[model samples]
Target: MALPLVPRAIAAQPWPALLSAAFLAAFGFVTLYSAAGGSLLPWAFPHAARFGVFLGLALAISYVRPSWFREIVPYAYVGVMVLLVVVLAVGVVGGGARSWLDFGPIRLQPSELMKPILVIALAAFYSAMPPRHIQTFGAIWPAGLMIGIPVVVILLQPDLGTSLLLTFSGITTMFLAGLPLKWFIGGGVAVGGAVPAIFPFLMPHQQERILILLDPSQDPLGAGYHITQSTIAIGSGGITGQGYLNGTQSHLNFLPEQHTDFIFSAMAEEWGLLGGIAVLVGLGVLLRWGTRVAMDAKDRYEMLAAGGLTSIIFFYAAINLMMVMGLAPVVGIPLPLLSYGGSAMMTVMICLGLLMGIDRRTRRDRERRRGL
Candidate 1:
């Protein structure tokens, strides 16, 4: 009897999450409008249009059956790997990274797509393996390969931001899958020890960003320009903000990447602390729904996918906000759904869609188990 109503319950749960996403996108559009000096032609319209298109694409992706997701994981992971290789051969360069593939009018970033696919593939891999193996060398090696291969490929593209995001997403999934806590502690120690050796290999600009993070005053007109200008913009906006479309820093061109990576600062300048808080609360709502779904997930696969995807969104939101405000080194991470870019919009929406897929599968599994 209760099983029959499960479908309706699942359908109703996403309204708050969906509304939050739309609202964030709308706020981003308005910021882009201001960023363009009150013109929609350049940034706002395309941003909104892409949101609509990806929202629809996400819906379609959500309908994929569990069996299909299982079957597609290997092929999807391999296909993205091939694209990563192709990118090394002839990838288009822009803004300091060669991560995009150009095919006339359509430019695709496979690394962006891989973030979520990595979640799916790893979840699928762990789902098939015996739970008992999760703590052994068997589980560690394969998962490390799944994560390490892409990290190496993208790091070579010199897109350190995306590589870190993938590593975070994959590791979060593994931890949630119940790997031994001591192993993570040991890995953390190893990673900490490796930093000294790895620091020299970092790109000059990347190293500069870290130095700026350490001392913003060191290169006020050079390396520190971004975060310095960004903090000013954020601090200028008081409790109620300077009013929408009235931010001076961005309008006067003091803020860099005002339409992309630093859009949140643009938003903070106009919307103020209140607006920032609102964005946080809104994203909190979206993530909360995902957390609930992950916690109540009906199976191991769904649990890992839902939880991993949720962690991925959290990663984007946290890193971008921190980078803009100077709490972290600038790594060129775009705010999820809010930043004016196609690649991130697609990645985040697919995450939401996949969560919806998990919800849908959870209901079906529940119904079937009850002989409904």
Candidate 2:
């Protein structure tokens, strides 16, 4: 009987998602290695090392009880909120955003931590709420406050990428909670009308980036340099890529932020279209598994949390890809599991871990219901 438990245990783990994550990380390691002039010391080694450490953290998180997550949601949200405030007070400035808390060698971005906690908080709130109240002001105001507070704080950090991500993730949770669609539609209309009025108030660089998006050639060597070079790198890697480690754009020092925000462009320049498809397929598998977990959740909280977590990953990957391809403005969002950054890697892994735990509970609940 004890021996038979071995295969059962192995089968219970989320191997498909794990394998997909590993594949992406390994691909990223290779890309970073190439990007660093064949040296692993700077980019490649740390990329792989952080993934290893965070993957362990994810596995540890998988073992946590779902009830514990619900219990900690409020404290976690409040704690991250405090950290965000602290960041505004004394955070280190990098990439023109005062978004990181520097503790000697360890740098923490509280905004990244807010993404999942916000999901859990919203899920817990809605799960505990009476069904009748979901359509009332009680529902909309509280959830809006939860999203708006963090967003306002982050925007003060002048980190547009993270603020948009938080807003989108929060909206995803609200939508999953069965909130009325008309509110979202109306909000979209309002935002659309407000954009024109808000344009002039934006920072000069921010306004220039938006303008550059429309006409890159007008400022190809200035504000548009990143997009122009990224486009060339991606376009040059037509089919099979320019052959790994031989990407002209990156190797020639033409690609900007090749190890972070534009890492996809660097990979594309070397690995080509086939490499891009491979990355996409890996992400596709991971996302499919995450969606299945949400669909199979036994309770409302689980479903909402899982959906929100999955959306976080989706938004990161989607935005990064679009930014590199010049389809979206460069907003400094890194590709999940593929970019060289500890903060994003930690956030994504935490999401995966939480998702796995939720998936585990869902399976166990199903088994119990069936008298397994």
Report the number of the highest-lDDT candidate. Answer: 2
Error of 1 at 293 (Å): 1.4
Stretches > 4 Å off in candidate 2: 1-6
Which stretch of 10 consecutive residues in model 2 shows the poorest summed lDDT? 1-10
Model 1: per-residue lDDT, tens digit, 1-372?
Answer: 356645875564468778999999998999899989899968999999999999998788878875587788899999999999999889999779999999897789999989989998989988999978887889888999999999999999999999999999999999998899999999999999998899999999998998889899989999999999999999999888999889999999999999999999999999999999988988898899889889889889889999999999999999999999899999989998889889899999999998987877786778889996
Q: How high is each candidate's TM-score?
A: 0.95, 0.98
Query: Deviation in angstroms for 149 in model 2?
Result: 0.8
Candidate 1 deviant stretches above 4 angstroms: 1-13, 364-372
Q: Could you tell me how far off, in angstroms, the CA of residue 70 lies in candidate 1 after the best superposition?
A: 1.6
Model 2 residue 315 distance off true place after TM-score fit, in angstroms: 0.4
Models, CA RMSD each: 2.7, 1.3
Q: Write the per-residue lDDT of candidate 2 for residues 1-372, one digit (tens) a residue.
A: 456756887888999999999999999999999998899969999999999999999999999987799998899999999999999999999999999999998999999999999999999999999999989879889999999999999988989899989999999999999988999999999999999999987778888888899978898999999999999999999999989889888988989899999999999888889999999999999999999999999899999999999999999999889888888888889999999999999999999999999999988988998999
